[model samples]
Target: MHASAHVDTFARDHLPPPGQWPGLHFDLPELRYPARLNAAAELLGGGVPERPVFRTPAGPPWTYGELRARVDRLAHVLTGELGVVPGNRVLLRGPTTPWLAACWLAVLKAGAIAVTVLAQQRPRELRTMCAIARVGHALCDVRSVGDLAGAGIPGLRIAVYGGDAPDDLLNRRADAGPFPAVDTAADDVALIAFTSGTTGRPKGCLHFHQDVLAIADTFSRHVLAPRADDVFAGSPPLGFTFGLGGLLVFPMRAGASALLLEQAGPRQLLAAIAAHRVSVLFNAPTAYRAMLGGLDGHDVSSLRRCVSAGENLPEATWRAWHERTGLRLINGIGATELLHVFLSAADERIRPGTTGVPVPGWRARVQDGNGDPVPDGRPGLLAVRGPVGCRYLADPRQREYVRDGWNVTGDTYVRETDGYFRYVARADDMIVSAGYNIAGPEVEDALLRHPDVVEAAVVGRPDEARGRVVVAFAVLRPGARPDAEALRAFLTAELAPYKCPREILFLDALPRTATGKLQRFLLRARGDTGVDTDGDQQ
Candidate 1:
């Protein structure tokens, strides 16, 4: 490994041991990065200084040169005034905006690890992540600072943007000249992304400077083939890796521009596509389904490429979208541990229901419980290895995720004779609702906090509107009424709105195994019923 430029080595010291790390591959030429590299510098330098980089509906596009200047200034504030050193963890919380993207780049340029979380995350969730990551500084939007401040993290210094405070991030200027990028090692930690797991604890995935560029080179370059003239737009928040790549990293890496929207629902996304003439789009299957009905009044002729992920894209949704827009959706399966899409197909190579073969520089196969490869057409766990692989931050679960140098994603699939992989179901208990991965246990914990609830279990139920909706089954205290609306309202105060259960049912007793363990499968079976508690078909 190259000598690190980090003065604080907390991130490096906490990385999973070499034996627990998944084997990394860099067979492609473009995947080879120099020993000393700064991802922000490479990304910024790859773009034409005069070309637009970020755009919004209410404002003019910010050119690459303008973005670089802003990033440099932010880096100066982080390193000079904030007294941050390399390897310090900086938590970023804000809506999707150009300034939030700039803050991400500035953190990398200054050689600090960025812990970017969703602005909608509750104080409890934020507190858990901050404690696990040892985050000391925060760059938050003024509108979203309440939650982070209420988290009450010890010694966390917050600098708000878009506010009238004298120390607002945008108001702090260090110098007029460019700030030199830190000479960091290629393997130096750049970001710590926290992902929800079945255990209800967030797993922090450690990524390096080179790992950031590797995704752009492998998937975005070889498969997506984005051009400099392409205008990108997406519905995901910047905190999600899907949005991080599609909205910021991939576009800037290709010298293209992106439309960053603070509110990108189906309606807002359709309007942005018509107003900005977006050619490349990224969204979940649920959003695509929602937009299909609204496409008649919008002009989407500028759309050339649309990528679907976060959940399996049903063949029906794919067909309906292709029939309407004459555009084939690029269906992909990726995990937060892998950073970006490693298994995907685009253009003429795409199949209706199956996720395409492994992306360039990546290898994937279906493995049995014993880590042995399963025969074609047999369902098994999906294991993948590539230039970017799993490396948890001092977590014991790393041993469970990486087996024999392969990252075993908790997803079951079938590898067909044609080499295409078909999605089956989540091998774990994670609930994929509206493109967000919600832990069933996390929601159950929130329900259990209510005074009227005695026991609770949560699961994902199939829905025509959303790909899946969180359905909860609970046993209330004796003589307490079954008030689903009241329970939902109480939960809303404890968890994010998305994580709250959409349907709640009262039960006298919960199913359990003979060994006294909760039988979640029975709860899932209950959720799969076609009729609701009132005998109305769902």
Candidate 2:
């Protein structure tokens, strides 16, 4: 496939003209702004102090009017007392709390970009991010003990928000002089979120101020479609875009209540949903799979919409979930480079094995080695373009990610004529065994279909003769563990011999990012990669 092929694949006949379906397509109306503050100000109508914006089971909910006061006070503290200068990088570390939301808005209101990090990140990772972003200030909650202490976080100044607001801190008077919103250009870097690549080191993805709202417009407007009366909940760390957008931004943007929890495991998520009447669930497929047991026992009638991402939605996982809950999962693909999901589909349009069409406002095409678009149902590298285009900040990785004005993500995909894109595998995860180029995810998807398997990941181990051999790691469902021979025979019966894993390694769990993606690089990083020394495969 060549670039010309991409042009042909998405020609006028294949898609409506650009911006053809106004409300259904291009979502510039909700997010068309230079800074993100406009989203709140516009929602509030600037008359009645913005309505209440936050809700939680642990404490009283805060309204939009009250939320604004926090952002204003924090912004004043950032500039007047804390000295967070324009364009400064202020690293924010905290759980999913109102304080966290305020910190995010405050940093932007004060003319600084908030650099968020996973509270679970080790010391070395924090140092790397601080150095790359040139962090000037840090706002963290001291409550998190142990490894999340920010031991290696280097900042010119540090402010602790949770313990208490200091008396000396700048708190705005009701009539304090015009604390006008900071002037921000559409191109200004609003955030620098890091996503771990196939290579372990996390890559910082730059997002503009305008992007803050584009995600809600695209995610909430087209995908989630949450009404003002809807209640929201998700299982992503606040630092992760998947979590931040779904739990915080998306609901608030629509004047809905977003349930926040310090922890959101399978049990916690289901409980929260039932308790708060949470109407939407935004989490990974793995979380959904894990909750199947509780779904059978819990009252989840409140959950109507579920969004699965961060990893491919296994066919079996989807079937089992839908079979148990009687609700189809809305599967989508999102990356840090694109800010939010550029390709997604509503549940009604979801195809079992494929990630549905390129989102309304976005254009996606699969290209071959020559960067030409591949025909429908054919596999190729995936590229996408939309209103929220790729613009990295001082990084050479951009050259490889963006070519011909289309952002070439690291994944492989296929398009079908009915308007859906299928996942092949990550370009880095594709293994070449003998003469065949095999996709690890495709094999893993097959393995997951087996009733005994709970989670699975496939990678290639180097071989002197075959060039590479397929290696799979699987986690079994709670009780029934089949013996090695039976499992091997089971796999052989299910898939083609060439696509089957040469060896299987069973484990309690697979290595995953905070967002719930299988980290294949870690599996390949193990010494004697094919050995499976744990001997848990059986």
How do the residues 118-166 of candidate 1 rate in per-residue lDDT, one tens digit apiece?
A: 8888899899999999999999999999989988889999999989888
Q: For candidate 2, lDDT tens digit of each residue in 1-538?
A: 0111111121112222232211212445654454324333333332234455667778777777777776776777777767666667778887777778778877776657788877777777777877766676777765542343446454446666566455322332333333466655554566778875545456677665666777877767887788877878888877888877887778777777777777889999888887888888888888988898787667898888888987788878888888988888999888877777878888678788888887766778899867788898888899888766555544556667777667788788888887688888887778888999898877887888777887888888998999989888888887866455667788888788988887777777888765576777778765243445354322
Of the candidates shown, which would achieve the greatest lDDT relative to the real structure?
Answer: 1
Give all TM-scores, in the order shown.
0.83, 0.88
Candidate 2 clash figure, as a count: 12
Cα error, residue 482 of model 2, in Å, equals 5.1
Model 1 stretches with alpha carbons more than 4 Å out? 197-199, 429-538
Whole-model Cα lDDT of every candidate shown, in order = 0.87, 0.72
Candidate 2: list runs displaced more than 4 Å. 1-52, 145-155, 164-178, 198-200, 530-538
In model 1, what are the clashing residue pairs, if there are any?
A: none
**Clash totals in order:** 0, 12
